[model samples]
Target: MENEEETLLKSQDSVEKRLGRTTLLDSGEDFEMLEEVDDGVDDDLPPLEDAGGGRKESHQANKTVKEITDPSQCPPQEEWLDVLGNGQLRKKVVEAGSSPDSKPQRGQNVTINLKTTLTDGTTVEEESNVSFTLGDGDVIQALDLTVQLMEMGEKALIEAKAKYAYGALGSSSTPVVPPNADLILEVHLLSAVDAPDLELLPPSERISLASRKREQGNVHYQRGDYAFAVNSYGIALQITEASSKVDISPQEEEELLDVKLKCLNNMAAAQLKLDHYEAALRSCVSVLAYQPDNIKALFRQGKVLALQGEYADAIRSLKRALKLDPSNKTIHAELSKLVKKHSEQKGAEQAMYKKMLGNPPDINTVQKPQAKSSWSISWKWLFGATAVAIGGVALSVVIAARN
Candidate 1:
């Protein structure tokens, strides 16, 4: 028992030596540093009496204080940025003035500004207000898709290549867009209009409405509303197809066919407005299929094909149209222009080939040198022989005179 007591005292002394003199002996078993409590006091004010409880409260308070002071520890904001699957990032910049309290809904008329930069360092900035009807071909597919995902008054930056934006043909330029050209658009949602109800109309009334819509599209085309005209024409085409199931009079059928052809023609014109040469070509081809000898269709197709750089096909189509309508000044002018251009191009190619082959001697340069060489060679030999004979004669005369 005395040895055990001595061992315990020695162990306590060693612990105290390591921990310092401020070590506390709890129930004569557990040892702790008194400095721990003292350190807590130094952090804030004087330490309280309830040592264990005070440490717990202090730790909790420190946690709460950190959460309040540091924003990273706070809860996230309600509205967040969403990235689209097509690698587009969207964010809401402002709420709509029309519907300030409510979030933006679909089928809104939005205003967007687009700026496109060409490789030549030229930039085109365009601002347009587009009305979007969900699943309707009112706006561009990308813009429509983007606006559907956006809330009212939301602003988004969209990145679309030419394929998605304008397909191969770019807006208002020739030679349709090059492959994979990226376009950036900044969109702002202004107001949303609710969708119109089509179910309310009777069957006959629906047919009439569709016909009216097609006529309206024609009117829009006449009035130079090409974008809206294209949209209206698309709706007309859809309505006419739907109405084809029911029996119609011969006149009505012919009217529908004519309207369909007119819509295709208008669509071609609209595509021309947008500088979509390939799309315009397709539209023109559709029109010409129904009316094979359509002069307008043939002429426009040739023009569009030419714009697309299909020069040989363009020439063929344009020449065929000119044969049918010999008096078309436009066709004649275009033919003349193409001929001159092709000739100049051929000449330039020949010149380039010649340049690659290096400069050859001119006929003047060759003839002048040959003539001088021939004359010099003949006179040089004769002059040398005559001089030698003259010297021999002089020697003979001297010898005779001396004798």
Candidate 2:
């Protein structure tokens, strides 16, 4: 059966999120719609209290988030660290994480399961798993920082003070977060991988990548992994299209053509295996359009046509392929079977027509015969020798009357 399995594997709830359009600023800060998340370990986490018994005030004369002038009533975060000078955020490493070496970077895709809460300890958001690229600004700046610091399989607690979070504006997805409210985030990092930006690579390098992907698809195909093969071949095709720039050398053009031809053949084979007849036919046709007499294209095209019950057209395609590759046993076997099926189909059609309306007018003489006369049923000598007439009174009366 034809299936749709992409190359990248994903855990449940761990796919990319849809944050709105993000514009990267000149300050290297990503500003986008961010998801609200918080640690769920504690149901009654205390609200963030200003060290001065209210919102922290800066001493830069503007009363920004930095300069804490008063230390009146502050919520104690014993395990948390204020790595940056600003009191706007704090981080607590819940688990150092199983994978010790690697963590998400500035421009990589990360997948994790996360939960978020408000300062009053009400759960606002949670995902069993999700994925997003770091530094994309599809989320708030605090999340990007948190993921960057997390290693694979690690869990952490992130407290984004109102300044680094919704600020005074709050969030668009939910109505719970009041203006200037802080957020708590807890996450379990599942995986972090580098997301490819294919457009950035040069044409030759893209072609090389495409070729490698195509080979990978072939491996998948050989193992009867049609779904994976389809995805792999699709990637190769995308890269091939990217490399097809208008300003290419003649040799490069030839190289790309060869690559495209092989890719089409492989893709068609996989699609056919998966019973995606229409897509497989299209791929084969595309190859034929480039190189009309390609044996593999012709051969696969015939198989697709046969599957559609177009035996006559299939026979022609198969015969053409056989002419090109006479020694190929596979082609020979398929063509022979198709020939027999075509003959049988024609015979059945004629039989059905005859059964419905009898044979054609010219063939109707088989049932015609001339009528035989009644005189032919008797001999002449039996006329006067009838036993019933010998003793008949009518004959005697006629004889007496005549006398």
Candidate 3:
């Protein structure tokens, strides 16, 4: 029995050594360790920690891995800077030529001449003079940074990301800059111009003048005084033109075109109102040439044609207008009345011709006798057969009675 116990103990110790773990032997009242291994084997292993602690503990490792994967997370290699003082530096460069100077001073007005294409495929050549106080929030962040670094009359090329320009929302009129888009710009510092003072002309007076002119034009147009309305519109156009030139900018070109289009359209309306059908037609045609799909021009053209006694042409024009504006009850009523009058006139002419010619038959008419229908023929045959049978039956009955 002692020999068997010794053999079992030795076998257990061999198993524990092979597994690299400490094992205990049962000795009736006490336990004994069978294997002894060094503590250095698993001492360097990671410590078991909770989720939060684990993240905090492994932050350095995670950062290392991220740096290896993405190099953009590293610090910028070159300092990104902007030379223009405005947020629109990128757009300015693309539209205008590069600036000649190297620095711009505080309170300096920069004038830039630019040529830009409109959304409607119209090209506008214009000049812009921008003046703002340095270090003010009036300029974009990137532009402000550049201005701080520059001296008076200095110019430089600036690259701006969209975040520094218009950001994600973009400008209302033109969306040149997109979100996160990188842009390049060249800027110049021109002679500074003094800001206009409202004290010279009272704000109230300015407002009153604008309101009075607009009201005068409206009243004249309503009262069928087209010449007066045209004159007023001309004055308004002049004012807008002057204002646009005073603040010479690339965007002003678009505004100028709009003003001109409005003036031309209003002038045409006035001419039509004054019973000058030919002149009105010419004006409308001119506008149509510029804007082929102008609804007002199309309507005015149709009205002028109708006034000129060109009923067919008027109808065609009005029909086209109606197609463009189907829900227009006024156009529908007008067309209906014209079509009815034309039909009535034709009917009256035909009646007069028939009376003059003694109701002569038309050359295309046929004069054939009307034939009876098959149903009527069948009914007649049946009636005749019934009458014959009745007479024969009466004769046979009389002969039988006599026999």
| CA lDDT for candidate 1 | 0.56
Winning candidate number (lDDT): 2
Top of the candidates by TM-score: 2
| Candidate 2 lDDT by residue in tens digits, 26-52 | 334333322223311111112332223
Q: Which stretches of candidate 3 lie over 4 Å from their true place?
A: 1-215, 234-250, 342-360, 364-403
What do the candidate models score in CA lDDT, each in turn?
Answer: 0.56, 0.65, 0.48
Q: What's the C-alpha lDDT at position 157 in model 1?
A: 47
Candidate 2: count of backbone clashes, pairs at least 3 residues apart or interchain: 9
Full ranking by TM-score: 2, 1, 3
Better of 1 and 2 by TM-score: 2
Candidate 2 overall lDDT versus native? 0.65
C-alpha RMSD for every candidate:
27.9, 21.7, 31.7
Q: Residues 146-234, candidate 1, lDDT per residue (tens digit)?
A: 55544455554454545445444343332123434555455666566664444443445445656666555554444344555667778
- Which candidate model has the greater TM-score, 1 or 3? 1
